[model samples]
Target: MTTSLTIAVKRIHDAAAASDGARFLVDRLWPRGVSREKAALAAWLKPLSPSDALRKRYHGETADSDEAWDAFRLDYFEELDAGGEEAKAALFTLDAAAKVGPVTLLYAAKSAERNNALALREWLERRTR
Candidate 1:
């Protein structure tokens, strides 16, 4: 039998919902205005986030380009594949949570479509397939 993991992605600034389940903040930096209470996170998995260099290149330099998005996904996947023990532990935490119920990955980016949380959700779903 296979368990279908329900992983949702949302902005940290948005109002938390009951459907969000185990909310994990998958960003390297804390969001500007949200307090710890406001975030109500199950965990802050910084190790699962993209490297600062990759983030800057994507957001600061080539945000509008399609090629950049592709490159970012490729590079980000590589990073996750080659990540350290901390990342592995964080992934394990997410996996454990998913086994119990749903999980929501939270991020601070302005773009609703393109962010590390979405990328990480894709990565997680791919691994489960």
Candidate 2:
């Protein structure tokens, strides 16, 4: 994609302030206490979220960041390669709009340190390159 893709962890409000062009939501589950209209999302990619197992395993903080990342990649591959039809559709929006505007992946999560959005950004970068 010619246009840059920004993946950031933020609440919808923070995303609003930071993202001025195109905004895409990348969470499997919608944030609690948030309405669909309030999300102000251009697109939502639920398939990109961490799997249930991974979430449960690394609910908050954990010792195995590397292992969690590896498992996350495996799960992401399943979303991108195997039964990833929806995943393709989600990513395709960004790919298709490469030249028109900035693309930001908005994630509604508390932990900005480590999460699915970061993993997704890396994975997308590696594959796109």
Candidate 3:
């Protein structure tokens, strides 16, 4: 990976004002009320998202609980590690985009700080270093 690689996370509902680099939807399920045209996504990398069971277990309701969130974060990372080919494919896609410039990961979670995109960004950064 290039030292210049940059990763950013943003909500899907947010307006996209820039065309500086790749934009990908990192959620396993397509965001509600967002059309494909409006999304303007380069890719919808479901493989990069948390599994259904994990997502359900750590839904938006868990955000307020630090302990739950911590446990979710740990479990999520484990899933990413054990994700095998799926995780590898997503990482490859991210790496390819990052080589050129910034790669923005879009998610639908209401809590910006408690989403998989943030976790994925951290995991990717660690791998890049």
Clashes of each: 0, 0, 0
- Candidate ranking (lDDT, best to worst): 1, 3, 2
Residue pairs whose backbone atoms clash in candidate 2: none
User: Each candidate's TM vs. the true structure?
Assistant: 0.95, 0.74, 0.91
lDDT of 1 by residue, 1-129 (tens): 024888899999999999999999999999999999999999999999999999888887677687888789899999999989999999889888888888999999898888888888888778877
Task: Return model 1's CA RMSD, one decimal.
Answer: 1.5
- The C-alpha stretches of model 1 lying farther than 4 A from their native spots are 1-3
Q: After superposition, how far is residue 110 of candidate 2 from its true place, in Å?
A: 1.1
Using TM-score as the measure, name the better of candidate 1 and candidate 3.
1
Model with the higher lDDT, candidate 1 or 3 = 1
Question: Candidate 2: which stretches are off by over 4 Å?
Answer: 3-9, 13-15, 60-83
Instruction: List per-prediction Cα lDDT, in the order shown.
Output: 0.89, 0.64, 0.83
**Which residue pairs in candidate 1 collide?**
none
Residues 51-99 of candidate 3 have per-residue lDDT tens digits of 9998988874557698888888788889888888877887788888887
